[model samples]
Target: MATQTPREAPAQAGRRLDLSAPWWSSPRWQEEKRRIRGELAALEARITPRRRLRAVIRTLARHGLLRLMQDRRAAAPSAGDASHGRHPHRDPDRRLRQIGRRLRLAFQELGPAFIKLGQVLVTRQELLPDPITAELAQLLDRVPPMPFPYLAVVLDEELPDGLQTFAWIDPEPIGSASLAQVYRAQLRDGRRCAVKVIRPLVDKLFQTDIANIARLARRLQRLLPPAVAASSDLPGLIRDYYSSVQSELDMRIEARNTREGRELVEEFGTLAVPEVYLATRRVLVTEYVDGWNIKDFPVDFFTFEERFERMIDLAHLYIKEFLNGRYHADPHGSNLIVWRHSKKVYVIDWGMVGRMDALHTEAIFRHLLHIRLNQAEDAAEVMLDVFEPTPYTDVGRLKDQLRSLYIRYVDTEQAGPHNWGHLLVEEIRIAMDNHCRIPTGLSLWAKGWSAAEGTARWLCPEISYHTVVESADVQILRRLLARRFNYRANAAWIAEASELVATLPRRLNKILERAAWNDFKLPVEGRLSEQATRNLNRMVNRATLGLISGSFFLGSALLAALGGGALDRIPGLAAVTTTALWGSLGVGVYTVWRVLRSNKA
Candidate 1:
């Protein structure tokens, strides 16, 4: 949070400390301080933010992305610049794809923290372009699995009985990701489950990378524009990510989240989380889900209706649970699997989730409902009210842009897909472009929504996520409105109203007394209207021109009349004086006409 210096402490600190004593001649306290300083110096040398930053740079440079990362503001290559077949260089799309590949590689090389960052960042389609986000979305936890022996070491250290508690663990892991590796196992009680053990040293690496991540975000932000306003806040995003990742770091939290998720989705029989058996910081045992991820689901064998229904359930899960305050953040294909032959949607991941309060829940609900009703201005207004404004923001322009996007995308006549996630993102993106800053919490939740819609798209390309959720959105909005108007919900408003009514007579008397004394004054605050402003400026400029022209005309006319003697002596002089008078008069008349025309306009 504060700046670092190369010195042991600071010059000011030395003024307040006993740093004057040499180590050998020092008193007990001074000797202790010197010893502590030496240890601190050694530790700093061994592990420092600078060292981690260098590793990041080296990895990026290896992937040929260091320059690209620094030059984030560079305009993307245009299609027109690229030649066709047998061209000397690649097209813009091709180049973008290449950059995405390189970025994915660099993130993988950066360690778990960066890989996780990339994974989460991809969900923010509003900020990142599609080609890049597509590649990053594919940046899975492809880290090589930690050996079973090493995992056993961790299990032995964390578990009371270790391997003995499990009837048996498959030596081969069923799932290996950046954070943990999962294996099929059985408890002594004959309960079959998946054992998820944190990979050795990953926790340490993630902690280190997370610290360096803040530094990296700071450096990258410097390489770009000022933080007037942005669709994405790099430092804030990193901090939010750190908090979310922190929860994942603890297995107990994940278990609690899973339990909570299961309870929320209990109404939908097909949608559920794998049962948690044993939970610990280093390990978690849960019922092993056997199903096909949406990506690999047998599309040919299943009907679109089945897929659509399952997706609806997922959407309801989010919409309903969001109001309740928690929903699975990452509902991507891998995280939620489809039953092998059935269309049951099983949510299996709970390490990360999104939450909302009454304000945000209502804001989001109303925004969506208003957009559905084609009340673009109201939706735009809702956003304007929720987000904090930044220096770059133009309120009028933001409203205009958001209104245009809403009308363009929400055409019921159009058969083309209208992605709800992209629509939401566009709202944020336009707001950001006009200096409307979205809070980090909202941004994080928006990404989760984006991922959910992306998965929905995969399942029902014919019926988009928006179409499926539209009806549900209406119901949710109705409930929201009901609650908003409920007596208990409006207690403060009712109290304020009652006070106003009770004091009405006294307040009116005061106003009447002031009016009787002729001392009442009304205050008005207004700005120059565009039309008025233009007319006022025009009048001032024309008046100035007319004044100068009129003076010239009068002077020329007088000079012409006064040049009688000179004219008799020199005929050319008389003619020149006449021309000057006529020209000045014409200019004066023209200036007057312009002023009149402007006033009429």
Candidate 2:
């Protein structure tokens, strides 16, 4: 047999069929499944059952399942795990202090992902153990230094041509993290700056890890107990993680972040975001702000209260900027460096920033105020609104539960002078327990505020955080409300709204085209029975009334016949009743017919 030239084929006359199937159900899904299964099988070969079990549990926990089980197991009497065993020492506030320390240690052991997780965890005083939460509150993940050889490669790539373009490249990294590491260096022109290089395999690792974690989370959510599932918004948390962490892997995204963050706080003058240096991928260069670590700064320079208040004021300013506009997402202590020369706040690491819609800005501020006023019911509604709770839950019950929870624990005195973050955390946990899904933006917002509050408290123990936050509310509310009524012509807002509208039509067109191609199949099975039941009930009611009316008419006719033979007192009553029953039957029949016709359509 002669083999034809490989490329030759008979041309089909008709257009090819495009099934336009779902990604999961499609043939491509099988390929992905095969690839993932192979990876898992390879992993299975390397690890023991115990280690694999731990990995699986962690994976499930990452996805959002087995958290409650883990919590329960941790609380149970351990066989021999001394590391996590209950502490013997019982000082009045030792536990609180220890929590922060334990969290810091946990992050260190968990590696970059867990350190970042702990960083996020500490921000959310509302979700975890308070002592641990407070402790993790202070934890910082400064990236460890990378090898000089790799640094040289990055410098060469960044400068292009050769390393001779730069005058001096620092041997030591100023900062490091899981995604990328940063080093302080001087440019060829003698400008002092920082160079950030993406960790070689960080992106690939994150992509794979995130995929596995997301899969695990979905599985856990489906398999986990209702209470655990209710308590944690695991999927949302993962999604938020994806948005923040994934962006960190992209230097270009970081560059954009630097630009946006700098622009946002430009008006503050006292705050700074580093100026981005235009260079190649996996390498970013920015002006280095000469600063003292805010935590390590001289405490003796000002009265304790003044220092605390100043920090509080700065925090308020940061929150105002974030809530009112696009936020510098990672406002943790590591990212928030205080510039020594100018005494200005410098925000570094803009990889994770979130934007605020007018609604989010309003709702968050409103929620804060409601908390202050002790309006638990109102606050719960705001919580629901902020979280965008599903309609399945009872709003009234949630509100009542919130009221009870708030009434039980929101102590004005015990809450301390400047620890609103702790209070916010409590509120969130209660909401979570009551089946509320915490909004990612709100969670991050809460986390940032709590951290700043803690920092401010540590710096200025006498400064009342409540007072600072309340003052911010007054300022923002006054301005925002006035703006609402006045309807100031904001060019930026107009431009954004215009852009949004312009994008909508294209998005809608794409969605409609896709839907049309996919046969526009709506999920009607669920609704069908409901519609039928309602129609059927209405139909039965009409039919019953019709039958009753017909019986009355017949009775009246017989009564009339009896009356014609001999006048009787009941005959007149029976005639009137029969006439009324006949009229009812006529109406019922019409009603049933109408219901049937509507159901058919």
lDDT of 2 by residue, 463-577 (tens): 5566666667667877578657654547667888999999999999988998989866656433234357777777687667667766766766666666654544445665565
The number of clashing residue pairs in each candidate reads 1, 9
lDDT of 1 at 100: 85
Model 2 segments beyond 4 Å from truth? 1-74, 77-139, 226-233, 302-313, 374-377, 388-397, 404-418, 482-601
Q: What is the Å distance of residue 333 in model 1 from its true position?
A: 1.4
C-alpha lDDT of all candidate models, in order: 0.72, 0.61
lDDT of 1: 0.72
Segments in model 1 whose C-alpha atoms lie over 4 Å from true places? 1-50, 69-90, 219-232, 299-305, 340-343, 412-417, 460-464, 486-488, 491-601
In candidate 2 the C-alpha lDDT for residue 17 amounts to 13
Error of 2 at 198 (Å): 1.3
Q: Pick the candidate with the highest TM-score.
A: 1
lDDT of 1 by residue, 393-507 (tens): 6678878888888786665321344556667777777766676667656655777777777777777777756677775966686778877898887997889999999999999
Q: Itemize residue pairs with steric clashes in candidate 1.
A: 393-434
